[model samples]
Target chain A: MSRAYNFSAGPAALPESVLRQVQEEMLEWQGERASVMEVSHRGKAFVECAAAAERDLRELMAIPDDYHVLFLQGGATTLAALLPMNLAGADATADYVLTGHWGEKALDNARPLLRTNIAASGKAGGYVDIPPVGEWQLTPGAAFVHYTPNETIHGIEFRDIPDVGDVPLVADVSSNFMSAPIDVSRFGVLYGGAQKNLGPSGLAIAIVRKDLLGRHGRALPPIFELQNQAKNDSMFNTPPTFAWYVLGLVLKWAREQGGTAAIGERNRRKAELLYSAIDGSGGYYRNAVAPAARSWMNVPFFLPDAALDKPFLQEAEAAGLLGLKGHRAVGGMRASIYNAMPEAGVQALVDFMADFARRHG
Target chain B: MSRAYNFSAGPAALPESVLRQVQEEMLEWQGERASVMEVSHRGKAFVECAAAAERDLRELMAIPDDYHVLFLQGGATTLAALLPMNLAGADATADYVLTGHWGEKALDNARPLLRTNIAASGKAGGYVDIPPVGEWQLTPGAAFVHYTPNETIHGIEFRDIPDVGDVPLVADVSSNFMSAPIDVSRFGVLYGGAQKNLGPSGLAIAIVRKDLLGRHGRALPPIFELQNQAKNDSMFNTPPTFAWYVLGLVLKWAREQGGTAAIGERNRRKAELLYSAIDGSGGYYRNAVAPAARSWMNVPFFLPDAALDKPFLQEAEAAGLLGLKGHRAVGGMRASIYNAMPEAGVQALVDFMADFARRHG
Candidate 1:
């Protein structure tokens, strides 16, 4: 069967080449004794696989020599809890910039564990814009300044990394990871769930500055301890071996496609194509997000008539454009064009949208 | 190349059929629009897949209507931390039965969260025996009694489920789940990491009694909350959807293989064959654990001359008997024959062991 254009926000589309390669190696990885999933994490083959993945990712992001890349489980939500435990030194306030749902949710997760203060909030405008860095109220001597660079649900993204003024800046880049080049040295940490731009679900990646670790010692759960994970090579416990391996494959694929810079251009083009389609609809369709803050990864838009939503979705699905239904938090439609979504897919989507708008306008 | 006999504890072997099925459907699931990994967890397809997995697990284990099955992430280690926060009522002392490394590690995790007491210990015997249940020191009004039914590293397994006498009993069945038929009503909670005896890594399943939930209020992280997970259908956050789907496939395979009882019987036979080979080695090879406490899933044995361990492992790998090298904690040889390991694989390992013993004796 021909593959459909998958535009789901996350656990989203992987490159077709990677999927085929994974399928080929599903039963036996690299002509090894067993599948990558079947092998031990401590085994030579998997350890090498994991190391290669980290190395490729580091090279892709141009991560500084002092950063530690960790393959973790439980996704980004669990990472939110771990962030405070590992980085938010006891009694230090954790400053969060709430741009959208994920930032708000992350703040909620961190609240119980740390004394937290919102440095900035874009919620007043229903998360359609990012408050400029100049306006953010930075906390004095905060353990870390946290923000979501790309909020998947609200389709908001930061145009540039926030300046936290000597405080460690951490970003939840789950939505926009690998879609563009990131200045790894500017931030103390950046983490994301692997399902979106990386590979599959069940694994998370944390590129954290080395010095920020081991501060809390062994008081936290060993798996939640970034220092311990980095020290033990992310095998403190059994990692999601299969997912990690897939992430490696995806990273390798991305590197072959000329790394994040080239992919970023393609992502920008895809986002522009879809956004142009929405804007060109002559008030028939709309994206509530501000142009400056619009995400290159997730494009959320709505039809003029609410009653047409059902038929639009049904027709979209029938046309082989899948997972276009928007997040329930902001109802309408979302076309998530991550690194794997080619310009052709966006063209296909734009073509469909134009045809649909012509008939339904 | 033909598949080797994978003896790794976990990220262990899955049924070849399941692997093939997964490979075939990696790009598109059930003729659906996206790979199960790409699809949203809240989508109709995944919800059905999760429900089917739960239903199959319930049927296989004979889980009562009062139980809520949860497919969680972050393995057993995370669950250990979740237990105290979820189960232990305010200021209640949680009871732990220390059998091996995992039990001790779990206790360590719980200590920071709650007042915990070692209800029993196998440490005195170097983790080679289960201190009989009758001898356990039950804490008065203990919130819950937690134990490892099988310590994968120590190669010790309980012959029968322990009775905690009206207190909630939680078992970490990571190494032996689905390898045997479990009476779900015998405990308040039965959870296991899926890498062993179930499916791939990254997913853990929890079978918890309904009445034992919702004790803790809004204090805990929502992802760790069992009631919330159940209510949201384990979509509390983006789950390890691919892992969860693979788990469903594994459960379906187990059911097709005539449910847990049939699989358990086969596991018993595999254990007996491997153990008989070890016992028949006439002191040339030895297993330290008490015979009555031997695990049906993990069979660890040591050669009389530990010097030959390296060559034995190398030769075993060359012979397509993979991961025969025992865990570093207990160095020698371990053949973990979970539900996925065919009887032929165990036979091959036994044959290899006999040959090795004869040559090196």
Candidate 2:
């Protein structure tokens, strides 16, 4: 009956503090004349909110001036299709580094709009490890090289950015966006659906190297045309007002946590604590992803005795932890501990997971 | 400083009750222990919310069993492109009835996606009147006939539905939805961007006839694919949660107001009060739109002496009636009284405008 520590991958858990602030301001934001949702996008209140959010995002990522931070709709899945439309002109081919489900899905979403070349993949290794950047067959004249920095489903990640020579390196950074420090200058474009590490599902934050914008040309639909949206300050159409409002609160929360670097350190410790619990569970708790490539956000593991999986999930739900069920493709359990999941929540999950392993192993 | 009456066309005011309810449930809904925005779309809580919203909408609209209601984002403008893509196959053209800015924009948005045949138009009349339905040149084999029922900009409305027979007649009821009773059987499709009469901007509600469900055969992307969206219950991707949630509250409010009939009568009285004030101002105020075709949702009028426009607007703002400025294309004053506008607000605007006419004009 008490507050359940939500473990849903996305739309994921948010800071209760941020939610409380939003609750206080839902009807009238800072004594403004309307609900945050009712204000015009061109109106000063929303304009200021959007600017502050991007500024906080830049400070958190240590984003360079050359990058254009955009708030868009459609989840990473939609961004999957949009990446090619915005980056690859007509017949241009792009390189895709397929580390896991999200990377492959991104390529699938883009393939209809443009040609795609697979550079490297860890699927051959059963998604247990990230394919090394050295093994990727870098296409010399690719429009851009795309990869998912963190794979949500299989819980894989690339610790280092891919070096693609002069090729633009674009990443789907959904699961790990605010969890850690990232070099913004290294990417031509970095974007993701906000449901995971950002705010909510309706908003996507794209940090693009300013020069890549508008090169897609105005011929694209106004919504997908990054140049048009960027020029108009992303008010080309009516945006998801409340979602953007919540994002402002989240950004404020991030700043209070001393930006992404501090949060990243906390996130690192949380991941290590949970992984250690599974590793020491003596065949009872086994993770599919390799140690070096395992994601700090999503930790997917299987009970050695598969039959106990049903009871494990049932008891976890009854005990107040929810959404720990694994993706159908890789059946087991997935505990997603994003930026909002305090270290204590991870410790709680690790302790319960270990105790379950001891009794049922 | 009380909450002023906001009359912006879209991103307009919401039901005060709904805003209060959202404020009350900001951190918890039914003790779910998560902000509605943070709940996973796939979770039982949100999926139930989405379903209940659709069910409530069906009850409000009296939408039949055969029609599917889709809650997607990208607004009516996106639907301009999506309609043609989903309904118009290769070598097909769609018919459009252009009354004002909305219809013209829809035509422009659909240009790249599919060819358009303007079956009727009133653009020559400065968008103040509707072209008679009888004089229309119907495209013989057009995919569908598109039109805007209530022109938000020019303050026009199609008083009667044009009989399009089997060629699905689609209406963008963005500014007009729920203001009056509508016969759902009269059209094959009905869609509205939520900003106006619904909830917020990012969510677009489409009521598509069952037969037209999945005809978008050629590799349609996931977000806009009607059939795919329906099959996945609009969770093909995460939806705009806050917008969707607020819309449910609005729908609930509508039902409590005795459904569309009672709301329609109240809207009629509000529109009449404003127009009577405009007509009785001793030629000080002039409404350009024809009497028979004038819209109840948006009442746009001009001052007798254009020079006093600035003073009039200032005084109106001082009177706590905000968003009275007209669209840039038409520089005058427009008061949009949606379902949320209490009768007292309209009375207040009328009283303020009348007093201003006596002093300025």
The 0-to-1 C-alpha lDDT of every candidate, in the order given, reads 0.87, 0.84
DockQ, candidate 1, comes to 0.70
The digit string of per-residue lDDT tens for model 2 on A160-205 reads 8878999999999999987888888899988888888778777887
Backbone clash pairs for candidate 1 read: none
Best by lDDT: 1
Off by over 4 Å in 1: A216-218
List ranges where model 2 is wrong by over 4 Å. A216-219
After best superposition, candidate 1 residue B173: deviation in angstroms?
0.4
Candidate 1, residue A94: the lDDT equals 88
Lowest summed lDDT across 10 adjacent residues in model 1 chain A is found at A216-225
lDDT of 2 at A260: 83
iRMSD value for model 2: 1.9
TM-score of 1: 0.97
